[model samples]
Target chain A: AQSVTQLDSHVSVSEGTPVLLRCNYSSSYSPSLFWYVQHPNKGLQLLLKYTSAATLVKGINGFEAEFKKSETSFHLTKPSAHMSDAAEYFCVVSDDRAAGNKLTFGGGTRVLVKP
Target chain B: SQTIHQWPATLVQPVGSPLSLECTVEGTSNPNLYWYRQAAGRGLQLLFYSVGIGQISSEVPQNLSASRPQDRQFILSSKKLLLSDSGFYLCAWVPTYQETQYFGPGTRLLVL
Candidate 1:
């Protein structure tokens, strides 16, 4: 079984501050992890993915996540938080060789950025 | 660039009403397609997926069904809408040789 856990239900921070959203996973097989963001009513946008290559994966809009196998974690981080960065974040995991790439999503973490 | 489109963007239907949602993809061929639902303040739930025309794999068994009549066209239908069916539905696709899945604009359904 594969599952992802986002440690925080919500996180609030001021602009220009470092941002961190924590996630941990449990998977029996080698897994592919991803970070996705949803702004308000918009659909989810892929942030980054870890597929056993580089542990640290960079994504769009200055977002990134590090795949830590020992801790079974993939935490999203950013040096600065823009107002535009306020959104819902989801951590996902799936078997690297799954038939349809079926993804198991975390409950979601809502980010609020204040100026 | 590959693109996926789902419509109508927002829908309100009465319970027991028949529902049909359409999704289409362009700029790619024989792409793998998926349908997922997300409830308010919840994560995405996989519903169905298709690798080719007329082939579909369902993740959740319910009143809903899916069909892929064409390579890039996917349809979601339900015999009758339920209050629990209300949610945001997304359509996504990945090229056969690619590993990443890209999503469409999504359709918000509200059942009353």
Candidate 2:
């Protein structure tokens, strides 16, 4: 069984400041982790993914995440937050061994970037 | 360069009405398709998945069903709409050999 937990329900960051969204996962097998961003009324967009090749993965729009095995975490980060970065972010996990390669998503963290 | 498409960007239906939302993928063959629903302030819920034509697997038990009539086409349908079904619906496709799933612009459904 595999699952993900996004520690924060909401995060507020000022424009030009750093941003961090925490996520933790539990899986019996090697897990594939991903971060997705969703703007209002828009579909979820893949930001980055960790497939056991790299611990630090960079994504579009200056977003990146680090996979910490000992911590069992894949937390998203950005050096500087922009007003346009305000959106809902989800942490997802998938076990390749699972049927259909089903993905399990976290509750999501709503980011509010203020200028 | 595969792309996914979903029709009826927004819809408003009366309770008990029928529903049909279509999704298609281009530039790829034998892709795995999926349907997901996101309620307000909630994460995505996987509803159905199809590995090939005429093959579908449903994840949740609800008033919804999915079908794949073509190799690149997947459809979500319901005989009757429920108030609880109002949410953002997303369609996604993943390559047979890859784990990353690409999503299409979602359909926003509102059942009155």
Candidate 3:
């Protein structure tokens, strides 16, 4: 079984400051992880994915995440936060062994950016 | 490039009414389709998935059902709408051999 846990339900950061959203996962097989962002009334957009290629992955909108195997974590980080960054983020895990490419989603972390 | 489309961007229906939301994919064939619902302030819940025409797998037991009539067409339907069924519904598709799923704009349903 594969599952993901987003440690923070909410994260508040000031514009121009760094932002971090934490996520942890458990999977029996080699897992694929993804980070998606959803703006209000908008569909979820893929930010980045880790498929055992590299530990550090960079994505759109200046977002990046590091996959730490020892910690079982894939935390999203940004050097600077923008007002447009206010949205809900989800961490998802998928086990290739699972049928239908089913994904296990985290509870999600709502980000609030204050200028 | 593949694109997923979900119709009726927003809908308001009375309780006990029938519901039908359509999803279609472009630029892909025999891809896997999925339906997901997101309740307010919550994460997404996988409802149904289709690997091919006439083949569907349901993840959760609810007042909802899904069907795939065509290679690119997937539909979410209900015999009767319930208050609990109201939420944002998302349609997604992935390549047959790929793990990444792309999402549609989504439909907002409100059961009154």
Best lDDT among the predictions, by candidate number? 3
lDDT of 2 by residue, A36-110 (tens): 999999988999999999899999999999999999999999999999999999999989888777899999999
- Write one digit per residue (lDDT tens) for candidate 3, span B40-91: 8889999999999999999989889999999999999999999999999999
What are the per-model C-alpha RMSD values against the true structure?
A: 1.0, 0.7, 0.6
Backbone clashes under 3 angstroms, per model: 0, 0, 0
**Candidates ranked by DockQ:** 3, 2, 1
Q: What's the TM-score of every candidate structure?
A: 0.97, 0.98, 0.99
DockQ, per-model, please? Answer: 0.78, 0.86, 0.90
Clashing pairs in 2: none
Task: For residues A11-89, write the lDDT of model 3, one tens digit per residue.
Answer: 9999999999999999998899999999998889999999999999999999999999999999999999999999999
Best by DockQ: 3
| Candidate 2 wrong stretches, greater than 4 Å | none
What's model 1's lDDT at B14? 100
Report the CAPRI category for model 3.
Answer: high
How many clashing residue pairs are found in candidate 1?
0
List candidate 3 stretches off by more than 4 Å: none
Worst 10 contiguous positions by lDDT, candidate 3 chain B:
B1-10
What is the fnat value (0 to 1) for candidate 1? 0.71
For candidate 1, give the lDDT. 0.93
Cα shift from native, residue A101, model 2 (Å): 1.3
